[model samples]
Every structure is written in structure tokens, then in C-alpha cells.
Target chain A: MSRLRNRTKFMNKFFKSAIVGLVIIAVLIFLHFIGWLGPVEGLAVRIFSPLQQGTRAVSGQGKSFYDSWLKKKDLLAENSQLREQLKSNQIDVSRIKALQEENELLKKELGFASESQLKHVAAKIISGVADPYSQTVVINRGQHEGLLKGMAVVTENGVLVGKLTEVGDGFSKVLLLTDNKSKVAATVQNSDRTAGLVEGQFGLSFSMTNIARNQQIKEGDTIVTSGLEGQIPKNLLIARVESVKEVESEIFKTAILKPIVSFADLSYVLVIIP
Target chain B: MWYKYILWSIVIILAAAGQVFLSSSQNAIMANFDLLLIILVLLVNLSSFERVIWFLVLSGVIMDIYSSLPFGIFMVSYLLTAIILEALFKNFFTNRSFYSLLIIGSIGVLVYNLFFLSFSGLIYYLGGSEYFTNWRYLGAIGWQLVNVVIFLALAFLFINYLSKRFKPVFLHS
Candidate 1:
């Protein structure tokens, strides 16, 4: 009788503990779902990011060796050909000086964006997303680096990728432009005209939505952010049109675009924080 | 005895380090081992139900700390798996049957995958329609299948080797 009673007591305690454990789990899942648990996500990224960095360093060693040993011979020949071209072009010094002045002026105009008050933070890509299914990348800048959630992330070439989703002490997560959930407001560069939302599709491609079929859209048209959200600065190059589709029944045409930046080859990025 | 625990701990840490560092840059063919799962399976086979339960909790905590997912999801899944396996061993079969062990381990892997998918689905539903799409679901299925197959092979080899090499220590205990 005593042993049976003890078994029942143990079973009861187990059941209660299991129930409590499940409840706690459900609540944590709920918090994560709603984006309230950003700190936990950041912590996870920080803990695992070192492993990713170490892996990349080890793999890159072999590539560096090959570059120095095998690629150097070809590079030297190409270097001399380029040097000869430079020597020939030395006669056009006056014309080159004029072009450099014009180039600097254009850069000054481009840099003088309306959101000049927004602070910019530079970051380096430490690792790609740990899980293949998730389109995220870890940057070396984080909360300690003054990065925050909703900060716009871009390449050094000024192409918008995504925003900071989670920020740790020394690292931040950038939801890549290829992620299905990512959307950015953009405009066509040719006319400075047609504006629509740029939605990322699978395989690193994106499609511009809400574009009218009759809008002066065409192949090779450049896309830039409209800065409607105020999260991202305006006129940043996003992509170029690869193809366009128009349907009579539909109100808007869809244009498939190739991203301006190759996300997979990203080594450095800039985070624009307002 | 204390030294043994220390050795196992070192092995577990090294395995995690390898998984994180070495496996990330390697080809998919070579990145097949889940060292944590291998260690957890070994511990389950070598220890009693109560001790296994504690180890499951510990492993789940470590995984949760390292993973981007929610904290307690792995804990619940690991504990549930441990309990089910323990119950199966106590009620139905002897541990000596290699075939039975394999079947059980495969089933456990399937269950873990199922739990992972369901939890991910739940997160999708709760978060928004944009959280998960058709292509993402397909990708998840592919990755899970690969994980399951790799884990099955690793578990089988480890069990076979351990049973042969440490028969007196593991089987007798």
C-alpha cells in the first residue's frame, strides 16, 4: 500500500512539472513570435557567431594561398597592360583633371541626401545566417556599436539590403533582401518616375509590384529606394529590371529585377541609423 | 569517475565547436555529423532514466542558448523524447536488441523533426503570414530529411561501436 501511494505521488509530481514546463515554453514562444524577445535572439547570435567566423577564417586560408601562388602570375601580366594604358593616358592630363572635378561635384550632390542628420555606422560581415532557411546575416556592429532595431542596412555600394532585426553587444542581425518578408519602397531611375514596393522573391531575385502596365518601364531600368518609410534614405540603388510582365486583367504590372549587389559575396556593409 | 565526467564534457564542448566552426564552411556531404545528438544518445544508453532526464534538460538548455529559436521549445522536446524512450525500454524491450534500438532511435528522430516543424509552424502562424511561405516550408522539409538520415547513420555506428568496445561497462550497468 505504501509503495503504491509513493508511485502515485511521484507520477502526480511529474505531471504537474511537465504541465508547468509546457506553459513556460508556450509563453516564451509567444514572446519570440511578437518580436519582444530581441535580446534573446541577439544573445544566440553572439554565442554562435564566433563559430561561424572561425570557420570562415580556416576556409579562407586555402584560398589566400592559391591566390598568391597561382593567380599572381596572371595578375602581373594584366598589371603591366594596365600600366601601359595609364602611360598612354598621361597625355590627357587636362581632360582627366576636368573629369575628376565633375566627379567630385556629383559625389557631393549624391552625399548631400535630405537625411544628412541620420548617423551612419560602418560594419563588416562576420557570418552568414546559421540556418539555410533563414535569410539573415550577422554584422560586426551591434548595440554596443550603436546599432538598433529598424536601422537600415546597406552595402558599401549604397544598395539597401534590409534592416537590423536584432542587435547584440558586438553584433547585429541583418534580414537579407532575399528574405520573403522583406519589402522596400522603390522608384525607377530613368524617369525618376514610377514608384512601387520592391518585394524579394526566392533565389536572390526581387519583383517590383504596383507598377502600372503603361508606365514607361523597360529592361535595364535602374531601381532606387523612394524613402517613403523614412527608415531608409531616398535614392539608394536597389536593383535593375531583368524582365517585366503586363496582364490586361490586373491593375499593376510586375517587373522581375536583378539585385545590384551580390549578397553572397558581401564582405562589408554600412548601417544607417536614424 | 569524476575524470570520466570531465572527459565527456570536453568531448561535448569540442563537438559543439567543430559543428559551429569546421562544419559551417565544409561541403554538405562532410557536414553530416550532429555531435550533440551523438553525445545525447550515448548518454541515454549509458545512464539510468533519472540521470538521462537531467542530461536531456542540460543538453536542451545548451541548445537553446546557442540557437536562435525560443528557449523552452528544445527543453520540452528533449525531455519528452527522453521520457518516451525510457518508457519504451522499461515496458516493452531489452536494450540488447540492436534492431530494436535502431528502430527506436529512428522513430525518435522522426518525432524530433515533427516537433520542430510543428513549433516552426506555430511561430509562423503567430507571427504573421509573411513569416513562412511555401518555398520556406519546402526548404525546411529537405533540411529535416537530411538531418534525420545523417543522425540515423551516426547513431547506429556509435551504438554499435560502444556496445562492442565497452560491453562490460555499458551493458552490465
Candidate 2:
């Protein structure tokens, strides 16, 4: 009789608690529906901000420790050799001059970056998604720092990295170009001046299609952002053409590109604010 | 009574933070085991039905905060998954066996991912999926399977290791 009473009491308590939990969940869903969750999300980011930074730091230290411990002597020898090569290369100034001449030739054809008025804010990328499934990173800048959604983010060398998709008060998330869902309007910097839509495909590579069949594009041509409608600036270097596929029956051809800037090595970027 | 829940909340929040950190740093994408799933499965095997339900609520909240998707999508999916797992646990499955653990983990992953993707697809479509629907989720699901295998093996080892002195107590409970 006592055991039965105890079991009945537990059941009653459980049912009451369950109802409370359900009500709580329902309230949260309603709150989310009305878009009152941004402040709450900002709070969560604020709380986890230190943890995120610490994780990044620890991982960096661990990697650096492993590298130095394994390659100390070898790195010293390579450093001396590199220093010697640098002295010799400094005397060979003509090599840089020739590269500059080739760069100017490419720019003359594209006719971009001459009259560009650049407005940018610098931010350090605190952490990045290592998974190939989604390419995103959390940066230290946010609404207080004037980061708005759809702002174009680029590297120090003016290479397009991604755009700000979500921004909070203290943090923001960037969506990378290599992400499988990402799409960018790009133009080829060649004599033909072909324009196409670049789309990420198969989690591993990108294919830019929609080029007219008669447009002439070489394998080694460079591709840059179309900068359509003044949101994302035009002529930001995107990728270089590795191969082009043309089907006579189709109106559009596709170009396989090798992304110029290495996404893996990115640690900082400048957000182009409008 | 609610103190244990508070403690578990702290633990889950820390685990979520760790999951975010791990996925973000050193490119450890291959080792991206779902820490949240591992914790919930352990609780499902060990806790009462009502407790699992509450934990699911907590799980949903954490995932919503951590994920970039709109709020409550994961919360709803997790609540449904927890109820199913609870039903299976309370009436059908034994918590003591290795095979049960394996089966539960595998099926749980499939159910959770499909449910999540369904909700995601709906929300994104409703919001207009012009460029948002090209994710390679099939490949990511394969990776999730690998993660499940690894995490379950470790969990089993942890449980078996604890059986040294409290074998009967640990196994039965």
C-alpha cells in the first residue's frame, strides 16, 4: 500500500512538471516568432565570447608549439637561406618591375579600381567553421562596430572572402564564397569581358556558368566580382579560371576556377561598409 | 529538485560552447562529433521520461542560440525526438546492452537530421530559397554517421570502465 502511494505521488509530480515545461517551450517559440530573440542571442554571444576567444588561442598555441618543437633547427637553417635569397632578390629589381607592367596591362583591360571610393572597417576573425559543409566564421566586430548585413568582407590584399550575413552587438558571422550555397555575380577580366554567375558545387569546387557561347575566355583568365548595384563593389578579385567547358548545343558555358586567395589561411578581413 | 537541472544546464551550455569552439578552430571538421547528442543520449538511457523531456527543451534552447537558423526550429525537433526516445526507453528498449546503445545512437542521428532538414527546408523555402538550398547535406550526414560511431564507442568504454567496482549497480541503473 505504501509503495503504491509513493508511485502515485511521483506520477502526479511528473505530470505537473511536464505541463510547465511545455508551456515554457510554447512561450519561447512565440517569442522567436515575433523577432524578440535578438537581444537574447546577443546575450548568449556575450557570454560565450570569452570561451570562443580562448579556444582559438589554445588551438593556435598548440599548433605553434608542435611546429616549433618539430622544426626548430630546420627552420633556423631555412631562415638563413631565405635571408640570403632575399638579399639577392632585392638586387634583381627588374623582376618586380616586369610583374607590375603585366599587372597594369590586366587592369587596363578591366577598367576597374580606378575611380573606386573604398569605405572599410577592419575586424579580426575570432573563429571559423572548419567543416566543408558550411563555410562561415565569427568575427569580433558587430553592430556597435557598424557591421551591417550584406557588407562585403575582403582580405588585406583586396581579395573577396565573404559577406556579413548575421550581425549582433558584439559578434558577426561571415558566409564564405566556397560555401555550397553561396552564389556571386562575377565578370572575367579579359579582352572578351565575359560576365557569369559563379556558384559553389558538390562541396569541393565552384563552377561559373551563364556565359554566352560566343564569348571568348581563356583558361588563365582572372574573374572578379561584378559589383552589381553598388552593394558589393565591382572588380574585387575572386578566382582564376582553371578550365572552361563549352557545349555547342547549350547557350551557356561553364568555367572551373581556382580560388586565388586561400580560404584556410584567412585570419583577418576588412568589411566594406556602404 | 530543480538543482540537478541547473547543474545539467551549466554542463550543457559548456558543452555547446565547446562544440562551437571545436568546429571553429584548427579545422577539426572531421572530429566534429555532436556533443549535444552524446549528452542527450546518455540522459535518455539513464533518466526518467519526464527528465528527458525537460532536457530536450533545454537542448532545443541551446541549439537555437548557437545555430544561425531561426530560433525554435531545433527546439521543436529535439522535443519530438526526445519524446520518441523516451517512449522507446520507457516501454521497449533495455538501457544495459551495447547493441541497444548502438541502435539508439544510429537511429537517433538519422531521425534528428531528417527532422532538422525538413524543418530547415520548410523555413528556408518559406523565406525564399533562391540561393540557399544547395547545401551538400548528404555528405554531411555521412560525416555525422562517422561521428556517431566514434562518440558511441567512447561512451560505451566509459560506462564499461565504471563497471569495475559497481558493476551491478551501474549496469542496471
Candidate 3:
């Protein structure tokens, strides 16, 4: 009877200590979740950022060396071919000038709105997805650089890859469009006629669903953001149609698409922090 | 004993560093080997339940600090895994056969994946989306299976090497 009482006392003390420890840990975790623990994150980034930068610098230098020493002849040949084409195409000067003016006008229009509305913060891709299972990439810019969550991240070529999901002090996580949770309001570029949603299904591909089967969608058509919700800019390249599947029971047809930017080769990205 | 703790801590730190550095490289494979999970299992098998619980708490704190997920998720998962292992496989703790480790490690991997998937699904549901619609849960499971196979083979080789080097320490008299 005495031993039983002692055991009960021990259990009570143990439980109380456990509860206290758990509460303390929980509070710490909560503080870390908010911006309160920014210093720690900053320190971590500082310690690790240099290593990434060093690796990139080394790789870049190596590539430049290879290009100069080994690929110089090929580059020269290509340059001469381009020069010949330019000479042959000289008769279309007026048409080329008109096309260039129109292109400039369009670019200026895009630049004005994109600059005013969304604060475009340019960043380089420090690293691609760390894990095969996660469709996340890391960018050099972070909260200190004015990056925030929900920022539409795009490639330099204006292809939408993802959005900034998490921000540290010096680094941020870009949730790629290939992630299963990613969804964007998109439309057919050729027609600007059909509007639908683009969603990532967790593989190498994304899918556009809820399009009417009768819509004149083809295999080679381009899809871009509709910008209906204003989360992303209008006409940003999303993907190219790969396959169209018609389901008897479903009201809309689904089209599988290949994203414009190759995620594996992603090196630099632009974060649009509006 | 102090040296052992220091050594293990260094190993964990190194493994985490490798995970962080390699995760960024363009050519590096994204699949992660659950170093924490392996270490936890090994420690629990070699130690007492009280010690196991303490280690679980410590490891949970470290993982919480390092992981991208919400802090308590891994802590809860690791604590539950430790408890389950202790309760169910107390006898198998002494059995260090390669086959046993493989089977046990595979089970651990499955449980870990299921826990995370269910947790993510719950989060998604609360956030107002169909959880299973994103086929990532399936993909993660497949990837984790591959991770399990690699871990098993590597663990077998590592444990065999360790046993040979420290036969008296690992083997029961």
C-alpha cells in the first residue's frame, strides 16, 4: 500500500513536469512562427548564404572558362550565320522597324502597370527544390529585401513559376507551380476566349480543368494568366497544352500542360511583391 | 559517456548540414533520408523508455527548429513513433539483424509518411480544399518507399561495420 502511494506521487510529479515543459516548448514554437524570431533566421541565413554564393561563383567561373576555351569556335560560327541571315533579311527593314516599335510599345505598356501596381523585386535563384517531394525553390532575396508572401514569382522571360510562400530575413521559399497546392486563374492566349484554372497535380506536369469540351482548344495552344483575381499579372505565360482528355461524366474537359520554364534548369527568378 | 553524446550530436549536426547544403544544388536529388528517424530508432532500441522519451523531446526541438513545417508537427510525430516502438517492439530492440532492421525501418517510414500526409490533409481541409485531390500524398509515399529502401541498405552496411568495430559494446554478453 505504501509502495503504491509512492508510485502515484512519482507519477503526479512527472506529469506536472511534463506539462510545464510542453507549455514552454509550445510558447517558444509560437514565438518562432511569428516574426519575433527574425534574428535567429537572419543568423542562420548569414551563416549559410556564403556557401551557396561560393558554389555559384565557382560554377559560373567554370562555365565561362569552358565557353571561352572550348565553345569559342562554335560561337563564332553561329555569329557568322546570324550575320548572314541579318544581311539576307535587309529588304524587310521597314517591316522590322514597325514590328520593333510595336513590341516596344507593348513592353512599355506592360512595364508601366507592372511597375506601378506590383513592386517588382528582382532576385536570383540561389537553389532549386531541396527535396524531390517538395516543389519549393529558394531565392536570394527575403523579407529584408522587401519580399513577402503571396508575391507572384516569375522567370525573366515572364513565365509564372510560383509565389513566395515563406520569407526569412535573407532568403525566401518560392512555392513552385508544380506543387499540388498551386492554383492560378488562367486563359487561352490565342483566343483570350476561354477562361479556366491551372492546377498542379504533384507530378512534373500541371493541368487545366473546367474548360468546355466544345471550346476550340488544341494541343499546341498557349495558356496564360487571366488576371481576373489580380493575384497574378495578365498574359504571363503559364504552360503549353500537352494533351486534352474528355471525360463523359465531367462537365468540363481537362488538358495536361507542360510549364513554360524548366524547373530543373531554374537559375534566376523575379519576385513581384505587390 | 560525455564523449558519446558529443559525438552523436556532431553526427546529427553534420547530417543536417549535408541535408541543407545538398538540398540546394541543381543536380542533387531531392529525396531525403530521415536521419533523425534512424537515430531515434537506434537510440530507443539501445536505451530505456525514459531515455527514449528524453531523446524524442530533444530531437523534436531540433527538428522543429530546422523543418519548414509548423513546429509541433514533427515533435508530435516523433513522440508518438517513439512511444509506439517502445510499446510494440520491446523484444525486437535486442534483435539487430539486417532483415529485422529493414522490416522495422520500412514500417517506420510508412508510419511517418502517413502521419505527415494526414496532418497536411487536415490542414488543407481546414483551409477549405479537398485534401486527396492533390495527388502529392501518393507521390510522397512512393518517394518515401524509395527512401526506405536506400536507408535500409545503408543502415545494414553501417550497422554491420559498427558491430564489427565495437563488437563488445553492441553485442549482449
Candidate 4:
């Protein structure tokens, strides 16, 4: 019985506290609605506004940073794609340039062949300096194309380049005029039509020897094949006389010659079909 | 084994073709570079004797088909070079190291040139070709040595990198 009474006493105390708490909450609500708590609310808002704004600013910056990252990723992909396109365009440009060069060479060759009324076969150089010991080039046309041994090979401008030394079925090897083994009967364009044997010296340059001391030869005089050799035709440009050497004790005068066409740049040539 | 031989034969043919292409005068240094010789030198150090011999013979035959040199000239040169390389690998360069490769490759180039030039001279004396030896020919030998050393070094580094990256590790029991 005493325990029941103590429990009731405890419940009464709890009810008293709850009633007081309810009354206080109701009074605060009334004060808030009647503007009685305005200064305290203003003070609380002023204290929390900076933190709220900081959170909002952080979220905005994160969103902007994420947007910029996405943009950068897209730009990188676009840049790589553009780089690939540029590489392909560069290859196309080089191909077009090569085709243009080949076309120009063919046109010039056609012009020369048609003007001279010479029997010829157009051939492209397949390889250059095939022989380590000799300055030789392999041509695409060979015995199959009626290119025989000792056939004269010339450039598009009718400049004598070499002769077919080794002729295979589908390919022919041309011994370039710069080769030491190369020899040609040439005549100067001067009045005397000075006869000399043009020989390659060390695969570097040409020297026209066996010239009579009385023959007048000077620098800048054009040297052409004299048609003395049955394989080579007459009046094909070989070289220009660079300098002439005369010695009274020597039996023959020699003239140093310079080839106008570079052997390295001989991409296409014409085989004079004898 | 058969497939390996076939692969090597194909490589030899390709090397021959590459030689023909590099022989062009468009680039002088590349023209002087002997890709086949470099491959042979490398192969001698790595492969078995029988396979190396087969490669050497194939290389010589294919090169002879394209070369203006007398028949059997390239074969002799390549064969002798293989023999020398084999001896050197067996004796001095037993271990497969970069320095060993460099030394062997350098000596191989020199030996090949010596044999080649000597044979060329013999053939010229016998009235086979019009080739005349000059100091400039020696320069070609030097360039070929440089090319061989560079190629061997690059190949060594690449193979080493690949081996290290993909090596299978055996765990201790």
C-alpha cells in the first residue's frame, strides 16, 4: 500500500513538470506571433546566415567545378579527334604533292619525246645505287619492255643519264654516267665541234679527255653525244664544260665537266629504243 | 620448329626487300646501312646454330639475286661472318649482355667487310666485275658499323623491357 502511494506521488510530480513545460511552450509561441521574440530571432538569424551562405557557396563552386571538368574532358576528346584529322590531311597533302611531281615529270618527258621524234620507252627508276661499288640504278622497264643491254637512258629533258648494263626480264640496271666505268664520245658545242672522250672520274664528276691541244674549249660550253657510239643517239645533252686544262707536254687536253641533272633526283627516265 | 624456320625465312626475304629499298640514293646514310647484316649479327647471338646458318644462307641467296656482285660472293661472306660470330659467342661473349653484343657486332661488321672487299678484289682480278676499291668504300664500312651498333642497342633495350614486364615469377613453396 505504501509503494502504491509513493508511485502516485511520483506521477503527480511528473505531471506538474509536464504542465509547467506545456505552459512555457504556449507562452513562447504567443510571444513569437505577437513579435515579442523578434530581437532574439533576429540575433539567431544573424548568427546562422554566414554559415548557411558558406554552405550554398560551396555547393555552387562544386557544381561549377564539375561542369568545367566535363567541358575539359569534351575538349580533350575533340582535340585528339582534330589531331587525327590533321595527320590524315598531312598524309593526303604529301600524296598529292608526289602525284603532282610525277605528273610534271611525265608531261615534260612527253613534250621532249614528241618534239624530237625519237623512239623511246618511258621508265621509272625503281631503285638507285643498287651496286655498292658502282653508281647504278634499277629501272622498272627491262628486257620485257625491249630495253636491251647498252641502251641509253636519259632524263625527261633528253639529258643522258646512263646506259642499261644488266638487263633482266622485268628490270634493268642502269650504269649511271657518274660511274667510273662509264665512257661516252662527246663533242663541244663550240665552232670546232671539239671531239673528246667523256669519262666518269671516281663516280664523282666527269672529265673529257683526248681533246686535241688546238681544239678550242672553254667553261660553260655545252657537251653533247657525237652519235659516234651506235647505242647513244646524236646531240643528247650530257654536261657543261666546267673548266679546261691544257699542258704542252701532255698528249691530250682534258676538260672538267659538270652534269646539270642531279643523279640522286633521277626519278624517271627514257630508254632510247634503238 | 618448322613454323620458326618459316618465320625466319619470311624475315630474311623482308630484309632483302628492305635492303633493296634502302639502297636508294635518296638518303646516303640509309643507303649505306646494311639491315640484313645487322639482323644476321643479332640472330647469331640469339638463335641456334642450325637456324642461324639457314638464315645466313637464305640471306645470301636472296641478296645475291638482287646484288650485282658475282654469284656465291654474298654466300661466302655471310657464311664466314656466321662462323666468326659463332666462335666469338661461344668463347668470349658467352653471356648475352649489351657489351658483348656491341663487341661482337663491331667485329662482325669488320670481318664481313674484310671478306667482302677481299673477295671483290679477287673477282675483279679474275675479270668478273669493274668494281674498284677506294677510300670511300672504307667510309661505308664505318657507317654500317654505326648502324649495326645502334640497331643492336635498340633491340636489346626493347627485348629487355619486354622480358622484365612480362616475366613469370615463380613463388617459393
Q: What's the lDDT for residue A223 in model 1?
A: 89
DockQ, candidate 2, comes to 0.19
TM-scores for every predicted model: 0.64, 0.72, 0.65, 0.61
Name the runs in model 2 displaced over 4 angstroms: A1-26, A60-116, A129-132, B1-4, B25-30, B125-173
Q: What lDDT does model 2 reach? A: 0.73
Positional deviation of residue B114's Cα in model 1 after best superposition, in angstroms: 2.2
Give the winner by TM-score.
2
For model 2, residues B21-75, the per-residue Cα lDDT tens digits are: 7655554552457666676777778777666666667656756665656567777
Docking quality of model 3: it rates as incorrect
Steric clash pairs (candidate 4): none
User: On a 0 to 100 scale, what is the lDDT of residue A228 in model 2?
Assistant: 80
| lDDT pick, better of 1 and 3 | 3
Give the higher-DockQ candidate: 1 or 2: 2
On lDDT, the leading prediction is: 2
Error of 3 at A57 (Å): 10
Error (Å) of candidate 3 at residue A131 is 6.2
Chain B TM-score, candidates in order = 0.58, 0.64, 0.56, 0.69
1 against 4, candidate with superior lDDT: 4
In candidate 2, position B12 carries an lDDT of: 71
- Report clash pairs, candidate 1: none
TM-score: which is higher, 1 or 4? 1
